[model samples]
Structures are given as C-alpha cells and as structure tokens.
Target: MLSTKSFKGVNVFMSRNLVPPEVFDALLDALKLNGADVFLCCDPSRHGHNDFHIISSPDHEKFEDLKAKGCNLLGPHCVLSCAKEHRSLPKQGFTCCLAMDGIKVLASGFDMDEKVKIEQMVTAMGGVLQTKASVDVRFVIVKNVSAAKYKWALNVLKKPIVTINWLYQCWNEHRVVPQESYRVLPFSGLTICVTRIPADKRKEIEKIIIQNGGKYSAELTKKCDKYKVARRWGHIHIVTRKWFDHMS
Candidate 1:
C-alpha cells in the first residue's frame, strides 16, 4: 500500500506509484504553504520507457497540464550511477538515486510490512508518521476555527468522540432541522460533517462548539439530551431526560 510520512517538518518520498492528481495537487499546495520542498522520483525503466524527456521550464509546452495546476517545474537533472553514466542517461532517475535537502519523506508505494519497518526507523530518529491520507494536507474549518462560531459548533457536535445529542434536540425543539452533509478532505482521516441550520440560531450553539475540541455532539437522545428552549414569549425551559420519559 502507498503511504506518507512526515519527518522533521520536511516532505520526502520514494515511490514507484503515482498518487491521484487531486491528492498530488493537495500535497504540493501544502508543501508550498508550509515552506517544505518536494523530491519526486520514479524509475522510467519501471514505466517501461527508454526515450524519456524531462520538462523544466515553467511554461514548457510539454508540461501544460502540470503548469496549469500551479506546479512550477524546477531544473531536471538525470539520475546517473557509475554504470548508467557510461551509458545513455534515461529521462528519469530510479527511486534510489533521487535525493534532496529540506525534504521530509512523505509518501511511498512500498508494501505495508516494509512501510512499517521504514516507519520504525523514522520514528527512532524523531520523525513522524503521517497517514497516506494526510500526505495531501488540506484545511479543515471545524477544528481549525473557533467553536463560538455556529458553523464550527455544528462540526464539533458531529465529531466521533463528542456524543452530545442535545443540540439536535434543541434544533428540533425550535422546529429547525439540520441538513446533513460531509466533506472528505485529502488530509483528514474522518469525513467532516457539515450541518445546515437557520442563520440566526448559529450563534446560540457556535458559542459552545468551538470551546470543546471535536468532542461535542447533537443533543437528540432521551438518555443524555440536554436542550434549552427559548421562546418569544419569554419562557425558557431546560429540557431533560425525565421530561422526555414523562412525555413517553
């Protein structure tokens, strides 16, 4: 399986496989944002090609697709060994010959067992193991923003660790139904849940959601739902399980 690892805040990788275009783009964007550099290596022979070409110019006609996606091509140099140098240089280098500075190895197509061995070596040297999913880092609004904002609050409620169901009950009590949505980002393991609610009531719950770290849930259950009702008639009621039981 292909996976990613982060080492000393650098991105490094050796791969015989290529990641999806979107995932690759995400990785480049993240590297640029974090001031990390990249070293991509592949064996042209493994790809079963000999007449290979490397495009280095930013506006190179051969790399229109990669350029359009904001990837700036640096100089291309052949990976040569003592024997290979005596022969004609291939367009691309083998995985072993590729090396660069300021790069923390990111992803590899190595098998799982080998990857674990590599990971152990890295961690032993104080490096970190990032899931292949996280190699392509992307921004997440839920954990990235303050919970006081209702949009973030909704996210907190949906997180796995926070099993609060009261918020959902509050919305239901106010006749508000939250439409369910999920965002699967390149970098995150869990699909982020986005709920739709009325604009005005957002501030009511956003106040609490950000304060809790992805550990809040919607209050929709009788066993633990705790909702507060605010009526235009100035009547406020603290909803509890007993009330739900009594009604049942």
Candidate 2:
C-alpha cells in the first residue's frame, strides 16, 4: 500500500478535459490520499515553478506556451502509475511524449555499474541500447572523449557524442534535453578555419578543433559556402577571435 505522504511535496494541476468525471474523481481521491496538492485549474499566478500540469493532449493550444514557462506537462496515466507504485514513476514511460523512443544509444567509458544503470534507464524510456558502435546508433554516451567507442561514434559513425550527464538529465527530467550543452565535443558539427595566426599556432588550433569534435580546413570549400548561406539566414553564427578565445 502507498504511504499517506508518498507525494507530500508534489503539486499537480489536473485539466478537466484530461479524464472522464468518474475517473477524475478517483484520481483526485488517490492524489489526496497520497498527500499531493491538487489543483483543478491552471492559473499561472497560483502555480509555482515546481508544479505539474496534467494535460489532455500534447497538441493542446497552450502546450508550447506552458512548456516555455517550464511547466511540467504530463499525461493522466502518470499520476495513476505513481499512485500504484507508491513512488514517483519516471514520466517518460507514462507520457505521450516518449522522448527517447526509437533512439539507439551506445555507452562508452563507463564502469559496469554505470553501464547497467544506463541500459536500464534507456530501455525503460523506449530507447534501444547497443553494445557496440553501429550505423543505427544515433547517440553515444561517454565519460571519456578519448575512448575508442567515442572516436568511432564521432569520426566514423558521425553520431552525436554526449557526456554521461546528458543521459542522467534526460532520465531525471523524463525528456531528452538539448544536446548542445552536454556534448562531449562542444565544437561538434562545426568547420573551423583559422587565418592571420602563425603556422605553429594554427596547428595547435586545428588540434583543438579536432579534439573538440570539429573539422579543420586549410582552404574554403563548398561546405563553407553552405555555412555562409546559413549565416546569412541567421541560422549559424560567425564569431570573432575574441569570442573563440572566451569559449576556449
């Protein structure tokens, strides 16, 4: 049986459209029994940053707006599941937004215990875990960028190689967070060209770029043209040496 205070600190707002009246009443009872603070309407002024909004549909008009406001939107089943388990279940499995569904993941440079946990969480979140780097692997979770699997995933497979913390954040948040902040190679997907620097200094820069998941070119190419078009469209940035130094 669930403890009376299983959800002591949880604050939830259930949309009237989320479930039938009878089901909603039962859920309300369950939430109350489990010591959750439940709200019938979503009033921005009344809710705090930690409050969850139980949504009826992902395509609801206010979905994007609520998400932008950092609201935790979840399906109705998430609540029932938590009540059943007597604990807070990961929202990824119960929500319609299966963040890692169909994503193939490979783990590298982690010990046995960590790998086991990663596999369990990835599988639970509807992702496939691969023991080796392969064509189908879309993401590589790495502790060390110098790991052989990391090199193969980044260089040969051209897959996104991210730090282990990325996986943990996704598991904790029950969604796949942005990769830019968690990438093992922050310079991934960039083509860097250095000019006006000495040859020795240029070599050092090139090494840094490659090590950080970037490509270096001696001369401009069609790739640069594509990036130029991207820049003109405001899709890409052309930063100065000062910015580069700050980032480095």
User: By TM-score, who's the top model here?
Assistant: 2
Q: Write the per-residue lDDT of candidate 1 for residues 29-73, one digit (tens) a residue.
A: 443343333456532232222222233322344344533443322
Residues 1-248 of candidate 2: C-alpha lDDT, one tens digit per residue: 45356777878887676554666887788788888888887754434545777765456776667767666666555566667667653433224334576799999888899998788667755678898768998898887654658668766898778888898788767688888788886565567766557787888888888877778877554455544655677754667778766545
Error of 2 at 187 (Å): 11
Q: What TM-score does each of the candidates earn?
A: 0.17, 0.41
lDDT score of residue 68 within candidate 1? 43
| Candidate 1, position 185, lDDT | 19
CA-lDDT, candidates in order: 0.31, 0.70
